[model samples]
Target: MACNKSFSSNYFLLTPEEVGFFDLIHILFSTTKFEEGIKFLDMSKFVSKPLSELGSGIEVALNLIPSNRNVFVFMLNFLRGRAVKPDKTSATFLSFIGLIDKRVELDGSIKHGDANYHAALSAMASKASYENSACIETIVKNHWKMKFLGFYDFWNDYQGKATTQAFLLRDKTCDQDTIVVAFRGTEPFDADAWCTDFDFSWYELYGAGKIHGGFMKALGLHKNDGWPKEEVKQDGKPPRPRAYYAIRDMLNKLLRQNDESRYIVTGHSFGGALAILFPAILAMHDEAWLLERLQGVYTFGQPRVGDEKFGEFMEKQLKEHRVPYFRIVYGNDMVPRLPFDDNALMYKHFGTCLYYNRHYEVKVVEEEPYRNYFSSLGAIPKMINAFWELIRSFTISYAKGPGYKEGWLLRIFRIIGLVIPGAPAHSTQDYVNATRLGSSDVFVPPKDI
Candidate 1:
């Protein structure tokens, strides 16, 4: 689990493949040979027994999910494939890509300066990112009336495969053409993508603070070489094109061609993590030119990405650059309230948190209520809320019109949420609904900061 020292002098790395059940149990009794499963550059500064036990237990439980997910997805697809045409696009465990809403057109009435317009557009783009290239291209060009720049599957050095996915599109308005980059989130059955969420390995940079190792890797963190200012090329081409370098180059060319054009970064769930992290890297590399043109960043159900120090660094950078970051959390969506903001993993979220309830009422808070999902006091209320959400699934269209209708696939997930409340709340449908139905006043920046 040893990483390149030049990037992070202090790091706690985990190689799940190297872990055994007995080794995990041993962590509860003793610290000896813990390095056999977990790697540390220098953990002695504050390595506690509770932290070790918690880390081991977390790895074991979360690892089971991805292992079981693979089989479940295979069985699901196999059964569905018999009755219908084989899905060419990425399909989640419960939902078919084709069956979900394909509407990409924005609201004709909602204009610029209103956050609803951009939020709705970005949410749709985020959902589109989950589909295949042809599907994404079709929606962007034919439905949204926008230009589809490109779609990519970028290389992740840790996964030893292209694990990250994103797309670029250009929207021409009356005043200026805006470039949008949408990063895809974790798919229900994609084990590799889920691993990115579950893997809690961390790296502590000199001034930037500790960051999630999985995300950095997904965002083109090279194996031996860290975030080099320039894209590293092998022979004539990159060994495999990485996301940060490739997108940075694309933006540089696209932005220069139109001086009036500015760009925005956006995503949902795991994609949201990448969305915010992308700007952090730009600031880290001192890419003032790119930062100046960065209009905003919008994320839905994004997880906590870094330690408090990292949060401070990003807040300062964003404030200095005058870039607004809106982190939208819908209802009890559990993704926004993790990896537990505790001593074991010191991750903390920064910036405006636009938290929405079942009615799509937004509350702008520094942090979402119940900062951790595993709260005993919030359990009963969350379940009651989940019950209401399930009922609303049948009645929302009637209340909010046909456009707000919930699909059968999503309804099934809502039923599952009765037992596990926040799981279903994390869907893109609710986030989209929140943008359209919720108040735009939540987008107004607070002066106190």
Candidate 2:
């Protein structure tokens, strides 16, 4: 109930339709109907449709049945009977919407919070699919994969985590000093939802912490496939202490396995919030080991998870280990700017914020030389990031190349802009100005007077 005070019902994982459909489909296709469903998919006239179009169609179909979400998933299972490569279809779809980059652009019509990168998998749209053909193929494939896999119901292994047998992946090669962890965020149904497909075993969060041994009722902290929420906070702050211990024990076990590696923490969206907090929490619990071994943090689109007091405390905590930390934001993804009130100004302005927005911003610094320098300075790093994104986009840019939508450089820049911690093109300047996370510079705390 208290947690409800922080994240309203709107914030909970499921909408009424989603909840109904998920449970409903779980029942519908638990048997042969699943196979019949697949047979039905073959009914589509365009079996040979471009993979991207196939995926896009699925997406539109699923979205159309907003209330009957299960039908979309059932259709996927049904289609799989025809031996469609559901995972690849899903991966392609994921790549389309720019998930690989750690963010997904929510269409303006959907209106509200940006879709968490964890939700649907999509690839960049194919060139033909955009102008000449419907995006149905690309969207459908991803939706089918998600539905068949029961991704919408990610906490399928709560019993295992609670029973102390949760699914987790780890590596002993890491320095005992440099333990690394990546929070799986809200969803760990599978990898490849994002373009990175970050190493599962080494990353800790994805393969290691994911306790998805079976079906679950959804009440656990997501880092591992455990109980969603076991302890409630008496104080209105993010559950940092609880999460810290959960992480600390894991690192200790990892270090106990091999004594050489240090620690690094990272994640995307809410997971990113945990990544930043893990070290802070560890430092509080075991300062000696944590501080000495702490390497850095890199989170994308992390939400502000605390009250002003807790936020300030975390600010100092992270600063101590700030050198290696880098928070990447992408393209005005709104999920990153959540759960923060105006009580804390610095953080309100800078901390727990997204680097990008629909309309990019230009800010001026006091006694600072550059006019809108953050935006100006930010442009270069984004361009650099875009270069790599071009490679990824090449797989799916369905738009005509050489135009704004089609140009390799421009399209990929938008893709890169989605995942980097700071918004592409401007927010890196904000990072530059940030004393705690950016390059070290002597900072006099702003006078509260």
Candidate 3:
């Protein structure tokens, strides 16, 4: 694909779809570069060397597993029944992650005035974002006693389908009424979503630095045109509405209706990345009205989205807007530790990191201990922590109460952690636990946005 005039000139994008089995093998030996192996990387100012090569390698590796068509078909046939059934919310392999902690009501201990109240609320909303519209509506309206705004599945310009999902809810108490927008994260059975996570493509904005290209596409990045302040009109049939534009319009209407209404964006995993990026785009467009009304941003197990420069830009934007940005990481959860914060990749995490250990101990840090997950020295400790977590699952209920109990499914997942240490730690259950059980002091709420 040729570079569009409006698109960023400096970018490195990889398309795993173009890689054949032989071409996948060619990634390892980069000496004789195969021009047709990966398409998109040949664009002007973007080469298929080293960085894009590494990204292509990662994408190909993921494609060989459940992220491919064959595995997806097998998984769907095996898990399809779960999706159709009323009891099961999703057909994804990790659907059981949401089932581990089924508690819908906010913790009674965390009162409305408590510092952790919004964090706890946001965590539950993030978890609920993974479920279907029916489940979300029931939980919000009946259990939480909140107003269900709407659930949306938005289009991804690059992927050519509606792959992004999010829902909005309004929680009004006697003291305040806040709007919560929760984005759905990667699903295990979704090849497209997995491809998105594995794709390390990036686009460098004029001043914002380099942002993840896959995420930008997922969050309404137009193919030909970069982010124009206003949505571009499509000729012939109107294209599907994107997540950014669509959500922005919805927020404008909602905030206009009530002068006091404020909104916060949140999500888990891939959703978390989108949650933080939502406001960055708002800041880019200089949406003073929405930025002023943006209460805070809370992300759980969010992956690194940009370089150090991008991080600095985001820090300035968030600080100038007076937005409280909280990045929650539970133990060695692997998602937050990527895409590697090394010289080669240059991805970094900024903002306050509320790091929670296995015992739900909270530590406010600039970044998590192990910024990269692939360290040889850290491997043993991560495994030890994983083993301890498995043991803790059985006895956590006795210590914390019945609400903290782990189910058989979660135990099975914990067992898998033995093989892949940080995998189980990325679950929504632990994040929910962190918000509810962890200290409230970590939350730095400014006087007002």
Candidate 4:
């Protein structure tokens, strides 16, 4: 009933054919004819098809079916089939329907003013520190109704030495189920994490601007997955970055296991950068359902990863899919501003920024033409500042490195009251603290910084 009201309000946004397709999906699901639904979709039509073509097909489907409340109700039942536990195929069909529902809501003109969404996201970001399995289990079991499905500890190295982690969570109690893949941020005093941060060489991606070579390699994308030569070359493109490939594999496996669940990808700092990247790569997949199921990406203090070209490409892709990327910034967190914004260097940030200033107030920055002021500075001054920042980053990295005798870096900072302006503003705790202050304390950004 609520969805119907929402859909009715935004009916203008939906073409006749889209409405028809929604009706068709609802009928097929209500009658338990999922196989026919899949056949009607015709996966071949999606592969290699651009968004316009895919959209056209949806239009045709809508034209053929009668749009009504039954369609919406059936679609909701399919998405919230918590009691049914449908087979994988049925699940996939239902998930596709669920994705369509989400896309409709997201693309609609209604304002998403729910504070609970932001609060829940902040809570998730706060959980980034639970790297140990037991701690993760405790948090999931005690704090929310969600179940801890599993944790993935992946290596950026080929030999499986240096590792980064992500965990999966599922909530089945709600009307619409959800699956979250949350990546952990840099450990307070771990050298390996710092090493991953420092290794920022630019690496070229096919059809996208150059990304941080270190992060790319750290995700193990350059390495082969032992697929047969022909299988590996099936896409006719060069090998995808190892991290992207690995994440895709894991996500595909999870989706199969939990077919009706919507996905939310998130992380903090280094992990936040990966969260932004994971969805960008996922958008390239031939499976239309995968992109549809993506709910949102929320990151805290993510660094600039690619150049302007990459940013442009991602902005277009994400906008087309009606996906929202919230890059939450706390104070003057330096990570969001780095790898240097120099156009010549090719590093840029994608998505709308929700900036929280020192007073823990918030403001939303829509995407615009970005100019890297650092590159615009006087030659001598720019060089001096760059050199100084480089040294400072290294020193901070080493202090946070595994070799540091300190138990944890954040604890040390708290004890000493050591608060620097930039990177220190980059912590997940700071983000959580700011968000806890609530929307009533929201701050508008001053016209002049």
RMSD of each: 8.3, 17.9, 8.1, 23.4
Clashes, model 3: 0
lDDT of 4 by residue, 111-218 (tens): 124443533443353343333565455556655545877766675533245466777777565365667778777654444565456544454455666566446545
Q: Which order, best to worst by TM-score?
A: 3, 1, 4, 2
Q: What is the Cα-based TM-score of model 3?
A: 0.84
Better TM-score candidate (3, 4): 3
lDDT of 3 at 312: 93
List model 3 lDDT by residue over 359-416, tens digit each: 8999989989887887778899999999999999999999999888888767888999
Ten-residue stretch with the least lDDT total in model 2 = 195-204
Which candidate, 1 or 4, has the higher lDDT?
1
Worst 10 residues of 4 by lDDT: 7-16
Cα TM-score of candidate 2: 0.38
The TM-score values for the models, in the order shown, are 0.84, 0.38, 0.84, 0.58
Q: For model 1, give the 10-residue run with minimal summed lDDT.
A: 90-99
**Candidate 1 wrong stretches, greater than 4 Å:** 1-3, 20-84, 87-103, 234-237, 445-449
lDDT of 1 by residue, 98-175 (tens): 244434556666777675767888988888888778878877888788999999999998777888999999988888
After aligning candidate 4 to the native by TM-score, how far in Å is the CA of 331 from where it should be?
0.1
